[model samples]
Target chain A: DTAVSQTPKYLVTQMGNDKSIKCEQNLGHDTMYWYKQDSKKFLKIMFSYNNKELIINETVPNRFSPKSPDKAHLNLHINSLELGDSAVYFCASSWTGATNEKLFFGSGTQLSVL
Target chain B: GESVGLHLPTLSVQEGDNSIINCAYSNSASDYFIWYKQESGKGPQFIIDIRSNMDKRQGQRVTVLLNKTVKHLSLQIAATQPGDSAVYFCAETYHLIYNQGGKLIFGQGTELSVKP
Candidate 1:
């Protein structure tokens, strides 16, 4: 079974459109994260949630909002997506709340904003 | 202003040759380090990890070395095969930073290419 899975492997949208990416993890992890990988392959954390509570909110713009309905699901919603948002979005989960723990990542959702 | 950066952007090696990827971190507070491998169409996968308490840790065919003095980290792969070719990244985090939500800072990444 896939430990971590995210929906819509590919997302193609217009410049001003809004969209959401869904993520789920069956590992029974307490912490879940959303990361953005730019064209240069630099991965940066956007947000993190622990047991349905918002934790880390990097300096990401307010356009990007992460919502965790429970410990197993964390979803990212992009408002008025811009061209700069064209990149791969990854969902990850770690068994412990500490960042030092090993993380299990989903394949990723490739988002292209035209 | 914490940052982790790779020394090289890409490295090409023979199939049987070993590969080494180096990374430098600016955060002295980072007590834990990890190495991740990312394939073309996938997310980063955990390969190996090392804590500040230890200078070295070995996995199946991967080894991670940490130098707390210089705040440097390296990953060495033994008998690198074609399947091992991917973008490798080094990340650092501190356990105590959980109060700040605990973030893992990833380096730019080094692309390892294995040539047959």
Candidate 2:
């Protein structure tokens, strides 16, 4: 069974369009995260939720919002996507809020804004 | 602001040879470090990790070395195979007393290519 899974493996939308990506984890982790990988392959943490509570929010713009209904699911919604939003979005989960713990990551959703 | 960065963008190695990827972190307070391998169309996979308390840790065919004095980390892979070709990233764990969970700061990835 896939420990972590995210939907819409590939997404292509026009500029100014809005989109959402869904993520789920069956590892029974307490913390979930969203990371963005740019074309340069630089992975940056955008947001993190611990047991459905917002714990970490980076310098991301307000256009991107992350919602966690529970500890098992975290979803990302982008408003008015722009060209700069083209990148791979990854979902990850960990056992606890500690950074030292191992993170299980989903395959990723490739978002391309035309 | 502190961040993690790689010294080389790409490294080419022959199959069955050893490969080394280097990373430099500016945060001296970082106590935990991890190396992740990412293949095409996939998320980063945990390879190995080390803490500030230890200088070196070994995994299956993989080794992670940490130098606290210089704030440098390296991942060494022995007998690299063709399947090992992928982008490898080094990340440092940053803790904030105000925040509930610590965050992971990732470095610019290093692409490792194994020539058959």
Model 1 lDDT per residue over B1-116, tens place: 11335344888999999998899886999988989999989899999989899999999999988888888899999999999999999999875543666789998888999999
lDDT of 1 by residue, A13-107 (tens): 99999999999999999999999998888899988899999888989989998999899999999999999999999999998668669888999
DockQ category of candidate 2: medium
True contacts kept of 1: 0.76
Clashing pairs in 1: none
> What is the DockQ score of candidate 1, to 2 decimals?
0.65
TM-score computed on alpha carbons, candidate 1:
0.94
Per-residue alpha-carbon lDDT of model 2 for B5-86, expressed as tens digits?
Answer: 5443889999999999998886999999999999988999999999999999999999999999988899999999999999
Question: CA lDDT of each candidate?
Answer: 0.90, 0.91
The candidate that wins on TM-score is 2
Model 1 chain A lDDT-worst window of ten: A95-104
Model 2 per-residue lDDT at B35: 94
